[model samples]
Target: MLPDTLDITAIRADFPILSREVNGHPFVYLDSGATSQKPRQVLDAERAFVENFTSAVHRGAHTVAGEATELFEDARARIARFVGVGADEIVWTSNATEGINLIAYGMSNASLGRGGQAAERFRLGAGDEIVVTEAEHHANLVPWQELAARTGATLRVIGLEDDGRLRLDEAAAIIGPRTKVVAFAHVSNVLGTVNPVSSLVDLAHAAGALVVLDACQSAPHLALNLGALDVDFAVFSGHKMLGPTGVGVLYGRAELLNALPPFLTGGSMITTVTLTETEYLPAPARFEAGTQRVSQAIGLAAAVDYLDAVGLGAIEAHEEALGGRLLDGLGAIPGVRVLGPTHGAERVGLASFVVDGIHSHDVGQFLDDRGIAVRVGHHCAQPVHRRFGVTATTRISTYLYNTADEVDAAVQAVADSRAFFGVDR
Candidate 1:
């Protein structure tokens, strides 16, 4: 199975916050699906860059500037390798939301005849459709909605099975002749269900549509290979993977990225500029406008290194076991309905559920009283909730540093909540 279990004690020690107490009890963080806790190494990496090599990248000719630029590019290369892609494929953004918007706006610009003949493939118009799934986060869904509104393109949705999995049989029918772009989550953030990426990719490809993968939920825990998946574009945030906020990644195939029109226009992205016209640089630089997130990029690189040293294979296996525990425990509780796939189905170490006769916020407060932190809301995936016929859900999401004890404690807290709230079996 896994190449020896991870050293849980040593891993917990890496996160200094784990030593702290909350509400007179030891803190148990299970909200990693929203954002993960950063380790000391990641914090130190960002601090080191800001303290020592702080300078404008690709702008100044000074020694510090050169060094800063070198480190920045080196970070890109390292992150690229971690995801099984080239440095040229990774474009840094404020977050995964921005990355998706960049591509959407870029396509909108192309539809307006911005990039000339090379960009014709990106153009969309009436009769063309953009497909997204019911499980997509608002970040992914809303952008495509805006794109459709802008380009006169129809927005199509692939319905989900009652179990929260994509309906592939219906998907084949939806991804047809007029489908220009097919976008779906690699793993649903709310349900914690891993989508069938290859099957969806095949359907989209057969229809001659571009594929965009929202990898925010998958990138942090799984070993990802965007090249192997053959998606034209993919995006993930660093904060969800033990790195700092304000930095995310957008991966696009080199050729398609070079051909797409730039979403933001300004310095560092252009090669030449006259009063009348300007020519932009290639791939990443073309998309990255204004001041870059230098220190944050350095921090994310450190996170990549940390994940690699621990082994993604081991991390995946660990999360799988934790997910199974979450499913079984939460399902056994009275009036608790666990969302997404049931036990024995593949899922990440995450579970979202609603308590009958109790509001999600009440459930969250009950758990917080016990020093157990969890997410309580629609989790930015309202469509998924709508599919499940609920307004809100309380979610527990684990990461590599989490232990089985924390999960059991959270489950017990949830079970006790119904009793505290006077909700009977």
Candidate 2:
């Protein structure tokens, strides 16, 4: 039931991998929540750069270097605009994990008096608390844990409800004056539940704490405006959003980024080098140390351009329909328990579920035999699985290119798996 505005056939054609078969059956990729398939446009973009304008950005003073720098910065500007931010606010990292690590390490360095007086706001003492949620991916959770360990700051978690939504009531109580930072996911990778960003932002800001959003899941599926969201910082990966791997984005307010000390410092980020101390550059450059992800950044720009051409609004609408189908079909199966919101609640086009008497690995293998690819296990958010009283679950995540038939096929396969495992009863 895709919307009239979206053409599933034409869109699927853009991704070459979708046309391939597995186990002599039409390949049905339902693991977009883990990583999305790349389109030819993005591939071509990266290839075009590597073949022609491959050069060190902002280092060499030659024609190729100048063009490469322009293209790299232009990619930043385009990606920044895609998420409703200025070019200066975007900092490139290896991946979303690295982006979060950059912020954590930067804050840790600031606490250690690295950035001096300008970084005072980011400094945390022993009594200060860093709050995250039970729904956070390990990428978001582990860094804060390390940051807390390094700074002697306590790490707190906002719990989840029975249906996997964040406990906002508990959040309000937990995010008190002692909270220095509140980090959470925009969308839960396991549950596909969209968290209350505005409400959380209000709570964090009210307590005079900085907010960091993990936008890895939301950036690919929803229409995003980081500036309008008002979170102090955010991070997303290119690979999750139809772009190449080896490149990710960290968006911070210009003033905050400027004030924050550099996490990784070396060549391309320094102003002047003395025998004793080295002066650093400004916001984006200060954070992007070493050689840049020149071609990958260009590919990411092309990814955003493809998304723009197709329209995020239409994509959201299409996924909503697919989500309903998944919820309805999967929920109707015997011995199957779908996690997250119940039938009518809003969520992205993804579901993580456990089948009674069936191991998640078995279920995943069962689905794979039928040419359906899905994500299994804890999905890197162990606490969410622990919250649901399960150690593992199978997940199917959808995107713009997925269609009603693919979701239906996946649903049927799950039901078939229960019978295969002698758990149909």
Per-model TM values vs. the true structure: 0.99, 0.99
RMSD of 1: 1.3
- Screening candidate 2 with a backbone cut-off below 3 angstroms (N, C-alpha, C), the clashing residue pairs are none
lDDT of each: 0.94, 0.94
Which residue pairs does candidate 1 place in steric collision? none
Candidate 1's TM-score? 0.99
Give the number of colliding residue pairs in candidate 1: 0
Stretches off by above 4 angstroms in model 2 are: none
Report the lDDT tens digits of candidate 2 across residue range 1-425. 55686988899999999999999889999999988999999999999999999999998999999999999999999999999999999999989999999999999999999988999999998999999999899999999999999999999999988888888999999998999999999999999999999999999999999999999999998999999999999999999999999999999999999999999989989999999999999989999889889899999999999999999999999999999989899989988998888765657999999999999999999999999999999999898899889999999999999989999999999999888889876
lDDT of 1 by residue, 52-103 (tens): 9999999999999999999999999999999999999999998999999999
